[model samples]
Target chain A: MIGRLNHVAIAVPDLEAACAQYAGPLGAKVGAPQDLPEHGVTVVFIELPNTKIELLYPLGDASPIASFLEKSPAGGMHHICYEVPDILKARDQLISDGARVLGDGSAKIGAHGNPVLFLHPKDFQGCLIELEQV
Target chain B: MIGRLNHVAIAVPDLEAACAQYAGPLGAKVGAPQDLPEHGVTVVFIELPNTKIELLYPLGDASPIASFLEKSPAGGMHHICYEVPDILKARDQLISDGARVLGDGSAKIGAHGNPVLFLHPKDFQGCLIELEQV
Candidate 1:
């Protein structure tokens, strides 16, 4: 079951520049960046109490975010992270209900060092979804 | 200066069905609904700490969310809400930097009975942005 919005992930061409944009003009504090090698993304977060803004850039080949940027043609919102109590169950149910899994159901450390998985964009009407276990 | 994300709005055609899907399977509480006529939307909110999920349905034909539903042809993530300490100043700076405002920068009571304004999608590369002052 989806609990709440954990984060809103944005695809950015430049993480440092985007972080500066948020931190300087928007006055949002950028958290330390982390690289999720499995997903081939370098993610930086703007911390909020419940939800966060994750600025993502491609780290290597076969990264989903890179394809999203190419198709989107403009850097913008990519996905919504939904917090779930049981990550495996949520992933299974979502897949059974015709949701596509971008990654195999595997827990990997994400921006906040939390276990996370991504859902394919084809599942929820072209919106990529991330399932995070907290 | 910014506060926490108040709501992450999504454009949906069926409010009742969406509410049912969320409340039934998601094990989440749906708050009381409110219609902001000025923005031409009947918004329902899912409460969360520092963040919320707003299910938006058009109240009339003039709503920007309506056109987005048409162009997109698929329901997906619509916008990201950034809680600002001063909405007025945020609007000013964003506009100066080539951000097109969908509204004339007026404060209308949104789903949570708080002042809210929408930023044009053109400014954020086809991603609609909402600014709420809490």
Candidate 2:
């Protein structure tokens, strides 16, 4: 099951550099940057007109986001997050339909304290999808 | 410059099946299927609360989307379409910044005759971004 697109995650090499790069060009500079210690990254949320573009840079090279960047080899849209009223129902539905849940059955509070769970990319045609419960 | 996300395009193996898969489970079944012969797709637009999810399947196997599906393995989200008031200016700016233009400079009318242009994913780190002039 899917919901509204919560945000589009963009992976960048450097947080400040990425912010500066997007600031003037897109006329987009509404930053809600925060660090998620559990996820191990600094997330910068730039408010777009219709959707929020999240800039994610790892706290260290060994983190998951960093590893994703190294493997992908470029900065671009990383994942599409969907906001669901019920995260557990959405996760269960997807898992039952042959999709692998990246996190444990439980979801942790993500950026802005919203409960989030990541679905394995392999299950979704190699594109990572996130489910955020509002 | 990025604009609002118009619609998140999902290239599936079959449009009908994809729509069926997302209907009952997601509590989503708002279909507005339309054919864009130029792009060679039968797009089934499913209205989400916050955004629209476009399910695309090629009209014929020789079409570009068919080839894309063949190259890729499964069904999932493809390109992220951004709604911009000015597509030409956005294209030029992106081109000036060394992003290759996938389509010609002119914006062609897409589904609902909305002007649309596709940007090369190579420049955006492997994710195809579409600019829809609204």
Candidate 3:
């Protein structure tokens, strides 16, 4: 069901600071910050050889990342995404197998302009799993 | 400096239950549990097409996962591992760039029999980062 590891998402209190850290010390090629209104966060992609690292910051008061930051304060990993060949098939299989898909159990367009679904952290042993159609 | 995303580590409360969930519902190829006394955790790797998912549980009272579980209780994503071509080079570069390398600033043999070093979460936006020499 899960394909390649798409990208790992990290919630940051300040996107620019995170970008500087990666760009300077980590020496990564960091992309321009993109505001994902639909996802309620601004994101920057740090290009890596095998995969990308996504840095996320809250965009709105209702943003889930906002709440995550409220609890963590120092920022933390938000989720890890895995690519899937088919989102609908994966979603159905996960649901039928008793895993709870988040947000009305439907696929939504993600940052990559691909269909994505989030699995509940509880069902996946406290890790928010995001499956993105590639 | 990072070669590939080796694996995403999740700290689980119950190793066996987590394994069952992945093997049964997720239909993943779960590997046998291995105990690392040095790291103080028992881990099982779930192989995916593109990468692997590591499930970790406390091995002893002083295990770091035990402390993480005490705070989270429900288990959660613990760290993300990236493969580096040379562990020593990566360590020196990260330290020179002001990132705090965890432990005594030395690489230890990890589960895959590879040298590994951990970075402090505070320096990397609260996400514990691991670099394994591959």
lDDT tens per residue, model 3, B40-68: 99999999876788999999768999999
TM-score, per-candidate, Cα-based: 0.85, 0.86, 0.95
Candidate 1 chain B weakest lDDT stretch, 10 residues: B120-129
- Clashing pairs for model 1 are none
Q: What is the DockQ of each candidate?
A: 0.47, 0.45, 0.69
For every candidate, C-alpha RMSD to the true structure in Å? 2.7, 2.6, 1.4
The best candidate by TM-score is: 3
Q: Of 2 and 3, which scores higher on DockQ?
A: 3
Candidate 2 per-residue lDDT over residues A23-118, each given as its tens digit: 854457658578787888889988877678788888754678878777766665678887888888888887777768885668988887888999
Model 1 complex DockQ against the native: 0.47
Give the CA lDDT, 0 to 100, for residue A124 in model 2.
56
Give model 1's docking category: acceptable
Clashes (candidate 1): 0
lDDT by residue (tens digit), candidate 3, A1-134: 57678899999998889998888877678999899898899999988777888999999768999999999988998998988888899889888888899989889999989999999999888889999999
Chain A TM-score vs. truth, each candidate:
0.85, 0.90, 0.98
lDDT of each: 0.75, 0.76, 0.90
lDDT tens string, model 1, B1-134? 66778777777767786677567645567877688887788888876544678888788779867887787756677888878777788878876766666755666776656777887754454467778887
